[model samples]
Target: MFGLKDLIGLIISCFIILPVVTFIRETGYFIISGLLGAKNPRLTIGSGPRFFKFKFIDIRRYYHVYSWFSFDFIKAKSKFAYISIYAGPILINAAVALVINALLANDFFEDSKTFWNRFIFYVFYFVLFDAIPMKTVNGKPNNGMIIYELLRYGKRIDYNEDPIIPGTTEAEEEYQKEVEKMKEIKWKEVEEEETFYTDKKG
Candidate 1:
């Protein structure tokens, strides 16, 4: 039966654990792409308007929901390189979860064992979904599907024009446009509210 403890756990999982795991997952891509000489790489966390950007990391307002790593171009453009890039998140998450599990088995972090266990569970959960070949809700192929297609057909077979990893430059441009649009909408709302007050005063 669901109770207060369950509710608290759910809140922590959604707001804290999941976001940290997501950042780690994206870090896998950032690390692999950097090693392969991806130019101007950027890691954007969450969607919607930007909150703050420092160095190559952009944190959005909704920081706990979605994240992605992008680059302008890769110096090593090869099938093997692409495969390594896609496999990065899966391998990294699995490695982290395994290491934690081993530590737990050795009587480490016993005081915070519950938190660590939950963290490991979410890590493996990400690995399981990411390592399976399937199409995502947006009709884009997941990393596993991309890797499988690459291995089997020697290329991506998706009809989607958008690249799996978007270019950082293009993404930034799109983000700026979205911000401007949002600003315009906010101004319109303010103007409407002001007009309503002015008419009431008359």
Candidate 2:
């Protein structure tokens, strides 16, 4: 399906269509997350350190295609919360695609009809592809899988709560023990310093 023309169109569309898609999708996350009362909703358009940011809009935008948003789940544990936060982008992108398609059907931009149609196709394709229920190459769950899990389980599934390695509780216990040992040593040093100063004063 991807001929030379299609490949060139995809490359061009990345520059033209991707940023707008990212902006709308990520902004939807922020708006929906806030409306659902998620604490500290943040919208960042790319991973790693932010290359640019909007303090007023609270969006950190980067030059890459990857983007992310997060919030405290304290108040957003409900099914609707999951829908609002996770499905917001998918829904918004769908809406945008529909609007573009409507405009295309009407031949709204006669001079730029080809470009508009291509844009519409790209947007729709992105929405459908992203809505698939699968983990991405980066191992992050897509919106479809997220929503499906929330519906099935009645809450968000936290992968982080799972063990880093299967059947290896001993590693966790050892890590905890090391932390406690460090804390005890620090406390002992503090106590010794306090005793030395008190004795000198006396």
- Top lDDT model: 1
Model 2 stretches with alpha carbons more than 4 Å out? 1-11, 46-52, 56-62, 156-202
What C-alpha lDDT do the candidate models reach, one value each? 0.93, 0.65
- Model 1 clash count equals 0
What is every candidate's alpha-carbon RMSD to the true fold? Answer: 1.0, 12.1
Clashes of each: 0, 0
Q: Model 2 misses residue 49 by how many Å? A: 5.0
Taking all chains together, each candidate's TM-score versus the true structure is 0.97, 0.64
Maximum-TM-score candidate: 1
Query: What are the per-residue Cα lDDT tens digits for candidate 2 across 47-85?
Result: 433345454232333455655565544365667766666
CA shift at 92, candidate 2, in angstroms? 0.1
The local lDDT score (0 to 100) that residue 77 gets in candidate 1 is 93
